[model samples]
Target: MTKSLVGYGPIRQTRVGVSSSRGFDSESLGYHVGQTLGYGGERVYGRLDVDYDNKGGKFDSKGNRISPDVNQTDQQDTESLSVNGSLGVELTDSQRLDLAVTYYKDEQNTDYGPDYGDGLAVLFGAKPSLKAIDGANVENEPYTEKSSVNLSYSDDDFVGSGSSLNLTGYYRDEKGRFYPSGKTAGTQASEVWQANGLTDTATLKKLASAATFVTQSEADIEVMGLRAAMQTETEVAGKKTLLSYGADFERENSEQTYYGQDLNTFLASNGLTAQTNGLTYNGGPDTTIDKWGAFVNADMDITDKWHTSAGVRYQKLKSETDTFTPIYEQLLEEYFNSPAISGISAAYGIDYQAGDVEKGSTDHDKTLFNLGTSYQITPNDQVFANFSQGFTTADIQRALRDVRAGFVVNSDNVQPITTNNYEFGWQGKHGDTAARLSGFYNESDKVVRFTDDYTVEVVDTDERIYGVEGSLSHDISDKWQVGGSVAYTRGQYDKDGDWLELDAVRLTPLKGTAFAQYQFDEGSNIRLQALAIGGDDKAFKDQQKDPDASALPVTGYMTLDVLGQVKMPVGRVDYGVYNLLNKDYLTVYHQTTYGDLNRLPASGTTYGLSYTVDY
Candidate 1:
């Protein structure tokens, strides 16, 4: 069982103004403004169960069934609306100006019930059908809309001693649409039970009696963006200096059209319908992308306790495509006359065409760097260090088509997806007590993976993480005050490998938080809180049967919360409670094939209250 429904609405506005001129005599001006609006929605339903056990039959085949049970249902809907505005002006005492605008619209609807099949028909024991391998009934709808704008200007002299200057600009737009619902035989009997793994049920009733579900299609998308920036600050040698620079440009163009029936003329108008179950569509044309960038940064204070910063960045990218279709020139002559894909096309000896890989274009360039340092040691202590670099790009639907013309085998390299970061830190304060600590290291390259029906694969592998973040605060007298924070992480996947099944383990190793507050002299306050998160024990990928006891081990739990506040006269009043201990935890796991992974369950003990006013 599956179900979902959600909605949203928002609006905001702001304005501010001020002016002054001194000479033992002053002229003053002031203005301020604000506005806000909001809305909300949510609904969900769930259920699923799959059980199988056959030990000692040494793997039985033929519609393979030992203990089978399957059932399915799903639903989804989403909505959104937005608006924002801002303006600020002060042209005398030091010059200032600002303007902002934002608009957005969103709508979504999804309905897929019929127990959406295809995990090899729930692993070989088929039954429970919604019919569609051309027997018709499946649906889809997608939508999107967006808008943005911003502008700014600033200047301050204040006797030309601690100068300042600033400038900013921005723009954005987006539109999208998609609708699908024709081509059934239950979606080709769930893609021939996920590409040939259909353990016979009379070959799934002779491929669901020669299926043919075709009748829904439409798509459209658009995107645009722009940005500009500049900033400066001074007070040189005496200590305190800052400088920033920027330049940016972007362009994207896309067009797609693929309507009802044309997958090889509906598989030659339904004639040799099951040579491994038909209809595998592919498309890519009318596409364009462009990008440009520049950046620089600096922050200095050489001595008097030392401080430094540096940065650099540059980027350029281009892509293009359009042309080639006739069902991709007859699947590129049946993948160059098969032979198990022409021996991987003579062992990757290039030139494997579908129109010699038509409509071509490619270009890329990148550069990034940064450095930092800080030290004080006394006057409350301080220390810091940093280094960074990151980049990402590649994948325009397999870079403009041609994955060995559909039998797969093409390595026309185009790499990008890099990162290198390091950090060290310390901070302290006494007399009410305050503190901070940090440690980090990250190195990643390439890394991109998605299969199980969503192609795209790339792995260079390299990951190592080290963590230690801390926070502490105290003031246990005169109305009390206390705080706490803790973090610890250890992630690994540093070479020497073989672990793919959407690998990305370690998501949050150890986390902690604690809080307390009390005040009885002013209005009123009382609060208490606690939190903890953890992860460890993960590994899965065997493709069937004891690949050494099929891994699955996850166990860790903790939760608690409480709050209260009061200050009435028509203004402050709040209350809250959560978890408190009604535990039956499970925080997420879903890899479905009825390997049944859906458990983020834990919600009990809830309460809320609120009120505010001051005019």
Candidate 2:
């Protein structure tokens, strides 16, 4: 009974590798197995991979090992595994069906280690007690789990000559547990004054004496989608053409749950009524999103040297979130409105009466379009341009977390982001060299940004980015070849109509890369590459808000790398030395999480070696 399905024997391979690095310490081990076999004259393949990577430690300019910052990999200190397989079969002469399934898990431990933060505010004439929610964020393991299943069917003659239809269904689920980032800048000496507007030494000490804690977060989502598409070769304008249309429906139920623990004293220090259960609260609402869309596109050859394509899509989206009253906000409102507690609040510059909890839902129906064309200027040169539109909503949980009681969430705060993109590019080859160049401009009506404290910034306005990029490769000779690429971009968003620049996360948009390779006669080659990142000091400091709380300046730096592969008795051994120049530079991440204290530097130099062969 077991011998009939497989028409041929299985082909299998196994891979094993181990790597370690210093400066910024990291160690990893990997093992993988893959197999392909014939099932009834068709092929089916499956793969399994297991990996363990412990990424920790940072370095200073002097190459001294140091503790990583909160922005770095807190504890990727565990093992991850994944398994996937695919199968395909022919249902008829013109019909086919395919199925695939995947599963992955990454579970790891976090050693929060004895709460540390007392010495941070020493420069401000105080010692702040910084603990991770009194150790709640500590002594816990975090993990990510994901699984997916996909099935597809296609028929070339479903509607007769020159017509086809394809259908697909997919389902996926993802779950994750994450630890707290770190205590806010208020606990750090440099950002103490910015946290509390008070400048007096006495009040500074009072602010520092307050105990601060962190939060723990968890989220999960299950999504299912179905799609149907049809294509037919037809003459729309008496020209050779193809038209395609598709409709898709996607529904996902996602929920985010956030909880934190803090002392009752901490609440009282901020003029908020102490919660009966402390500061533990659901930071946002549980949410579900339903979306469906349909699109039609056409491709036409207007002439021998010109081509054009265009499409439009209609989308219907609805998001619903549960109503939840934050414990801390409720406690604050209680304290503020109570005449009995007025004196306690007035001592801290009491504000007006805070209102009840806020929550709402948002829905949208819109149509989007995309257009593109290309014209050939010569056999080896052509230029193309396109315009496209994208639409989506901001993070619902974040919007719920930062809601104002009196404002309407559905109408104002929780709005969809609509982005418009324009791009033009040229591709060509001259002699033994080939080149490509492109420029693009993009604008989004709404975007989200985060500060070091994990507080959310709902842009809700316009974010515009424009950039130009180009790459060139030349065969200097048969044995020597060189290529390089460079790109520059400028990004800014409207904050209350005052356009502000983007920060380091992705906005450090100037970069250049160059590589040169030397080939040996036996198909072995060694390549050298260099990367240069331009400094960005304008965006972070240009606003002139609070010096200590803002991101630090990033200086330009360059690093070189060498890679080569040599054939041996067993297999082709691939080796590489990264950061060959050993340039010591601080990562943009180290500065963006929080300011000036305990910044992390990049790795000095790293090496890697691996080999693979068919059996």
Candidate 3:
């Protein structure tokens, strides 16, 4: 919401608001302002915004809390700032140049209490006993800064009559730091005690008094790109047609640095030579990616009621990764030479041989195509069908790290994934009513799957997924309106044997939302909404073939919410109550790398109020 300053014409607009919700110790504040200046054939605009958030922790079903428990600070707090500016110049009648720039910074400090492990034990039936400790304090502080600038030039008749050309160039940089406290130290203690089969209370207490494990890390990313596009109107067999094409190239650089401890070597240096050995993580790595893409499409009227379009895109990607050898490898070699540890490793089929950092490069090239047709039954209604192919590389971050026991690369060969998608839909509007229905079928090859294991491994496989979605809305009168929407999805893995329901891939098969609203004569309105999420338990139980391997099912839940606004002379009052009924449900449920179940519970009831003025 915004309000204009008096006597400033269209040059000044300002906005401000305050919001409060349950579980937070303090309210949030936001402010924004924009200004514009215009002269002969030129205009410039700029905007500045700031947001401050004070996050209050949440409560579980038992009324226990898991918020920051630090001694002196707001456990979960965030501050963000954004600035944007644009300049436009009318070089000539049909030619123009525009330049824009944006900068954003987000900084957050978060703390966690001890009760964090309660839900994990109860819901997942497994505990990170080594990592979760009583009286242990956990904190995460991350700061991100980003900025971008773009320049564009356009000409209406550069390529002849009824033709236009546009070109753009841009560059962006993002830098951040990821620092965690207390977590690594706690886990190290747990692993050491377990590996040594130690249960003596006095010994355990003495070990706990040792130094905590901590790491310092930093990340930097940079991107630069350029694009050019042209559009023209022409006649194809006497039918007017539009042809559009574009080409783009981008380069990105990513780097990460980490500093940590080596448990075995550190303890041995302190006269504790008999202590069990455990590896640690430490290093700095970098990856560079270059991508090039080009696409062309044609839109033409086949008949009075029918239209068709065809397009194809050619994409090429090249990536190179470089890693530094960490301290863990050296420690592993030492352990291998010791007779005591060597026997244990040999019995377990363990290989302590470490390889040098796998510095290498990979490339991917693909040509994707799209075809579609639409038929207009009336001026306000239409039905369309589309088929398309797409290609995407695996997660870059995942490619850089191995969660395997030795933190080794899981595989030496990596490949891109491809998807084939088919879709059809119908959309129509009649009077005060509107509706839509759509269905889609998609198959993907070489999809990445992370197995539920302590040391995670990335696997590739084929899969098919299909879904349908629909929505309808109608206005009963000038003062009342109602609308609702629903979606359903199903998926299967293309295994060597019989196809199985994609167990590793968690998807809620059915979900829906409905709402009703009342509008007053003076631009004021209130809305009530209901949302339903279907349980995955029933579907899993029926589809799972192996009883021993099946996981706990996800339960279904429904919630209610309300939103309203009141119009005043110079401003509007806005408010909302989320989860009005305080429904208890899990928003997400899945297995973690350690084979432990993980769940994120939905928030309890929360309310917020804010005001905006247009002065």
lDDT by residue (1-615, candidate 2, tens digit) is 122343444544444444434343432222233333323454332333333334333233455543423332343345667666667666776777777888888766533322234333422343322222112233335677899999988889985676899999999999986644333322442132334354677755554444244444667888999999999889978997889999999988877664553433323332111112233455567777888899999999999999999999998888877767543354445434456545644665655444545556778988999999999999999999999999887666665665545555574557788999999999999998999999999999875776545456566578899999999999999999999999998888776666777777647648999999999898889999999988888787754553322445677888899999887676577788777877787665765655443354676676666666545
Give the runs in model 3 whose Cα sits over 4 Å from its true position: 1-11, 23-42, 50-54, 59-64, 67-75, 114-140, 176-218, 261-285, 324-354, 403-412, 454-458, 503-508, 538-552, 589-600
Tens digits of per-residue lDDT, candidate 3, 352-390, equal: 554456566778889999999999999999999999998
Weakest ten-residue segment in model 2 by summed lDDT: 268-277
Error of 3 at 397 (Å): 3.5
Residue pairs in candidate 2 whose N, alpha carbon or C atoms collide under 3 angstroms: none
Q: How many clashes does each candidate structure show, in the order listed?
A: 21, 0, 5
lDDT of all predictions: 0.49, 0.65, 0.61
- Clashing residue pairs, backbone N/CA/C < 3 A, model 3: 3-614, 3-615, 4-615, 24-56, 453-593
Best by TM-score: 2
TM-score against native, each model: 0.26, 0.81, 0.77
When 1 and 2 are scored with TM-score, the better candidate is 2
lDDT of 1 at 501: 25
Kindly list the per-residue Cα lDDT of model 1 for residues 1-615, writing each as its tens digit: 111212222222222222111111111111122234322222211111111111110001111111111111111133445556554555555665656667665444322222224432422234534221222122233445666666666666534644555566665666544433222233334343434454457755644433433332233445455656555676666766787777777767665443343334334422112122233444445566677788878888798788898889887777665554433333433443445445533544423344433565667768888899989989898899999887666556443433433332122454566788898989888888888988888767655544333334554566555678888988888688888898876554433464322222334546788888898786788878777766445434332232322234445566676777788775566666655554445443322222331221333444444544433
Query: How close to the true structure is residue 509 of candidate 1, measured as C-alpha lDDT?
Result: 46
Question: What lDDT does candidate 1 reach at residue 405?
Answer: 32
